[model samples]
Target: MNKENLFDTEDILSEGGVRDLFEEVEVGEGEKIVKQGDAGTDLFIVDSGQCVVIDDKGAGRIIDSLDRGDVFGEMAFLGGELRSATVRSNTPCKLLKLSREPFVRFLRKQAVPGTKFLIFLERFMVERLRKADSLRVLISGDQDLSGKRGLQQLRADIRARNTKPLLSADDPILSEICHWIYARNDQVLFREGERTTDLFIIRKGEVVVVDEGAGGFLLGTFGANDAVGEKCFLDGKPRSDTAKVRGNAEILMFTRDTLVELLERDSSMAIGLSLGLGSLLARRLSMANRTLRLLTYEELREKAEVSRLLSEMRKSLRIKTLH
Candidate 1:
């Protein structure tokens, strides 16, 4: 096997001080690097070749034809989640595989800046997931249940649930707040730290919450009925995480100044918002933990079964494909 270059000083392995753990492996055409439903223990960086990603529906989608300097398999490494998709070679390929132990060790030892970089990478991946979700909605013909609900109804629901008053037409803050509408597949929101002047509330459809993992693996997903960008509004801190459209989404946006003014005048409104945010965070953490456990267990079971079946078939079959 040809040892292709895995990392330079600029790569994550280098930054994490685990650059030596990766070694190159050459693969033939049609070679399977990682199969679906496997417990991913290593991440592969493509040095050369085209890799095809196949989903569960037998739909072979080429997410990206990875070339030199592209990384894959990090999702499983970071979260201990099952492989959500399969990767196969389309041509003669060379890749570098980094095992989990050294990878984790590197992360644990890395300095704060390196950790922050990993977090940015995790946030970037989450943003990509949002884009993927939006694309799915655009291609699929599913009716959006939330889209059918009128804005007035959504507003009424928010008002009825809150002890404090919702924004009224006469509220001075309303004039300063701006609304940005993202149709299906629009990147309507962003993670914390993304420089933007808007705070968003889901007016329609759903938004996903993605935790930023500085130089580490992405945390997970957060679904609809979630509010985002409130942290930025409260302390002017960079976005803590990313928010994206789950479907055709409409968002109520407020500028920083307007939000601050509202908070100053209506301390009750601010308190209620904080409480709501705390609830959302609690629910999100719970969901993430549950998903991690479920996905990891499922992946372990599936990998064992697949490995056994593949071994049996390999021993039993002598026939070769004509194609």
Candidate 2:
């Protein structure tokens, strides 16, 4: 098997890069590197020996194996949540670890590269989710239900009635993956920091995005055809913001299993989907960068408050380290 490079020589040549940030650590055989449900802020990359990723739910099934260059603990590191799985060294292992604060600092200093890194990480996470979902399908012996007549009936109805259908009737890839859901007013679709495998598209009514870090602010209201949960779904992390229905609503849900199956059958469709999502990510990142270029007075005040919070957090971390 080919090994993965954590950082290229060019990246290492740059001052204060990821190569300079990670610290080396050694683990004995049968040692647990990370425990499921424990909050983790560091990401680890295996340098040598072997490790195993095990899901602790119901008798501890082994999800995957990690050899040289494999990375773990990234989901919790990126989402600021508890670990989803346990990683244990199968043999004496050499590892490189990078903590959250330094990673954030590196990103701040290297904006363009950092954005590309995030995209790479998102792609990696998506592959991992697909593998997990596919494994579940194999173990359960579940049949693919995409050939159901109900979906064809729904597609026909959408074509005749809806002027702007979320997926075209001819798009078999999407047709196989999408299913309808109903939601009532004030119903929570998903809460912040909750892990989920499904993505949604609103077919009717609206939903509000509530972000607590922004002081319970309603970031925006999304209406028909708007996609929610895609960002975290793509990144394989917990939801970053809470989504609640504003009124009676119809939604279309898509699962990672369907997408993986689609890719297995048709590679071109997968490429097209990735390209479309990649462009959306690029536009969103550009807009965010533009917003950071100019801040209002209130925005400036909020920024200062964020800095103050970070200061307090650093002090708390220091105290913990001392003890």
Candidate 3:
């Protein structure tokens, strides 16, 4: 049974914000903390002592041990699903509980700690999803294994087409982060002002990025190894451009949440991705600067100034390779 605390105690404890939000409780040995099939909306962190997580669906198997700093009940709170496992104390325990409402309130009030907590929380769910999916594949046997291998190959093909840093075909986690999409000719992937969470990599064929304003202008046509929807995705805003398939196309999608998880796991990969995005942004800025040539001298000077700022911006992103 794979179970580990996804959050660091130091990170959580750094601000009294989250700690202050939690209500403390003391429990005697053999006390049930969370029951299977219960409508659980709160999360628990063990302050001291031990607990056992039992998978009630399968002969009540003991899945993992919980100790001080260990957290449980998060999956239910996050997914708004029934508790799949029952957690009970093995020894007298001290615990801190956080309900969903208060946690949300804290997040709205305390941005820094809230951001850190959410990052840890997202990573936790990603890990759990990975393990659960792996277990499902394993139990399904050779047929599923063969299917997964084909999917892995597809993931690799899309990864090769990504504008970002090269991800190894052997990186099993990348398969989880990237999703494949197929579109027919003239398909509209997304429209301007639509709220979307995905950044797209064109694996085959082409995509035209269109900006709507002044009768809708085409920003550029992107082919294999090019990414789109990044500006809005990274800025946490609605899509500013529409993506239309120029022909039948294959794409790999990276949702913002999963990309954050990937970056958390691999700093080198994060640096590589940042460099790639920086390069792309620089090219766009240069192109935008060139478009100013049609304007008057003052307008062109403004564009030139903006281009200079962009150049400085790219230089500011110092890349450091990890050992």
Candidate 4:
């Protein structure tokens, strides 16, 4: 069977530039654009030519590739982690590069196009993350992990994940437009593949995302101030994971239409809200990448161990007369 590239990107962007917020950098063929474990938090867009994403662990392997308009280096750009993969230029290329510091300043200076760009990035990142998680589950299915509740993600501290609170205590969305929800424990907020456009922020209590297909594989557990389904809020795609209440919880819901209306009425708040969504999605995507890397390494080791044992067993089964 063909190996599916888990990093499926949303092909919604092909602009000359995102309001000229990015700087163009030239690269030559076979040049390593970004290296794994490097301390770089800058994102790059394939302006022209191609590049390959390589997992620089052990013997190393190619994870994916990028062409015009595709994004790379975002795992570190959003997650504040070291570069997770090495990107090498396949051809002499021109890349549009932007870091968080300048991206924020551009958003403030030109809110309209900047907001649109931020919204696009947030949605794109969500799609990218969904593909990564989808592949993770598929890989786990290869081995009978029936009793294994989850992959290495379970050991990670939920409160200290790459996801950050989308808003603070004084955000206006909490006051004017949010639909307050008081949910009971074990209540399902939303299910995977459901068509819903509601975005939820946990006001008090915990929310957990689960993959019911894997016999309740825990995707993530989010605490107060974290967003449960921010992706559904922007992209009209079906929900990727089911969100359930862990306890009696208070959730603030916002409809995309309502947010659009509010942004139209008061453009001043656009930069803050839109950028916040971008940052939140960036961190979530970063976490997903890290999880993917961990899962990949574990799977590799498991396969190597099985091969070694099989070889030993074969040797032991040889006829004594042969010796």
The top-ranked prediction according to lDDT is: 4
Question: Model 2, which residues run further than 4 Å from truth?
Answer: 1-16, 129-323
Give lDDT tens digits, candidate 2, residues 1-323. 00122212123323335457779999999999999878877878787888887768526977578777666766556545467678899999998888877766666555334433444545554443333222222222333434533534433432333234334425765666667778999988888888885677677888887665445655446677555676765655677678899879988776666455544565445433433343333323222222222222223324544344322311200101111
RMSD of each: 17.0, 19.8, 22.0, 11.9
What 10-residue stretch in candidate 1 is worst by lDDT?
314-323
**Looking at model 1, how many pairs of residues clash?**
15
Please give, for residues 30-115, the per-residue lDDT of candidate 4 as tens digits: 99988888888787878789888777884677756777766676656654657767889989999878787887675566555556
Task: Please give the TM-score that candidate 1 achieves against the real structure.
Answer: 0.43
> What is the per-residue lDDT of model 1 for residues 35-65, given as tens digits with 9 covering 90 to 100?
7778866777777776766654336654435
- Stretches of model 1 off by over 4 angstroms after superposition: 1-16, 60-63, 113-117, 133-142, 146-323
lDDT (CA) for every model shown?
0.48, 0.56, 0.58, 0.65
Give the C-alpha lDDT of model 1.
Answer: 0.48
Candidate 4 stretches greater than 4 Å from native: 1-17, 142-158, 161-164, 169-173, 265-270, 296-323
Best by TM-score: 4
Clashes of each: 15, 0, 0, 0
**What TM-score, to 2 decimals, does candidate 3 have?**
0.46
**lDDT string, candidate 3, 238-295, tens digits:** 7656889987988877776655576566644543444355334433432332332222
Scored by lDDT, model 2 comes in at 0.56
